[model samples]
Target: MSRKPSTSHFLLLLIIIITVAVSAARTSAQSTSLCPSSSVNPEFCPINCFRPDPVCGADNVTYTCGCDDALCAGVRVVKLGPCDA
Candidate 1:
């Protein structure tokens, strides 16, 4: 016997896709609002203000190397150095 995709399966897939898309959009919007228009994501909005060890983030912001990559503010570490100006 051969089995085919069911309607429920399709609906579930669609729901998952929509959820993911919405989440991505929300994140994008947040980044735009937080970071400057010239930047991509709000990976570095200076929210992690502290002693500077010259660490750059994925969104082109600087942070201290002392701060762990797992920032509670949701910033992603790109490199352990000052961002290119």
Candidate 2:
């Protein structure tokens, strides 16, 4: 005669699968970090806005305003226009 699997055995297997899935998810989530070019001293950084003004930085990255280029990006302002221009 063939033996049937017990309910407790099935429950244990389901718990193990759930635990492994959650552990994998947390590991992946923690692997992502802030970009290196972002502001190191964010306490004095300017608030971002949607104004039409834009400025280019010495690093060639276009920022939304002068404060972003100088304070947030910690780079000198290269020009008063977008870097793509």
Candidate 3:
């Protein structure tokens, strides 16, 4: 004879599956790090300066900017979508 799962057993299994799925989704949605260009001038660096075309991954949301050298400045962040571009 075969036994069926009790309601509590089914609930527990569902909770476990949901927890694992949520964890996986969170991991996959993490943002990537960005580095500024190596030739940016600090004196002219705008507080909100960012590149028009940024290289981004799936979870790009925030950005950080800094000058690396003396001629080029850049903003780094995961690529935001068109709305944020």
Candidate 4:
């Protein structure tokens, strides 16, 4: 006779999936070491976080800005050098 999977097996599978997702998220956060800061301070936040625009920060580094403006935080813009171009 054929048998069906038990509820415990389903629960185990769900827990494993959740654990994998959380682990992946942590890995992503740690991988973004280039963005040392967040867009919490306007002083460092980009004036215009338009895509296809690059910003040279006070840290003496240039970054291609995302629409969210999280990459260029806690620094002033030196000039424009969009990454796409």
Winning model by lDDT: 2
How well does each candidate superpose onto the true structure, as a TM-score?
0.39, 0.42, 0.42, 0.43
Tens digits of lDDT, candidate 3, 1-85 = 9998899999999999999999998887663234443444467555454544433433433323322311232333434332254
The CA lDDT of each predicted structure is 0.61, 0.68, 0.48, 0.59
Query: lDDT score of model 3?
Result: 0.48
lDDT of 4 by residue, 1-85 (tens): 9999999999999999999999999999777554334545556555564455556555666666632253435455544553332
lDDT per residue as tens, model 2, 1-85: 9999999999999999999999999998776432224453678656666665677777888777554535576676656767875
Choose 1 or 3, whichever is better by lDDT: 1
Off by over 4 Å in 2: 34-85
Candidates 1 and 3, the one with greater TM-score: 3
TM-score of 2: 0.42
List of clashing residue pairs for candidate 3:
39-71, 39-72, 40-72, 40-73, 56-79
Give the best candidate by TM-score.
Answer: 4
lDDT of 3 at 2: 95
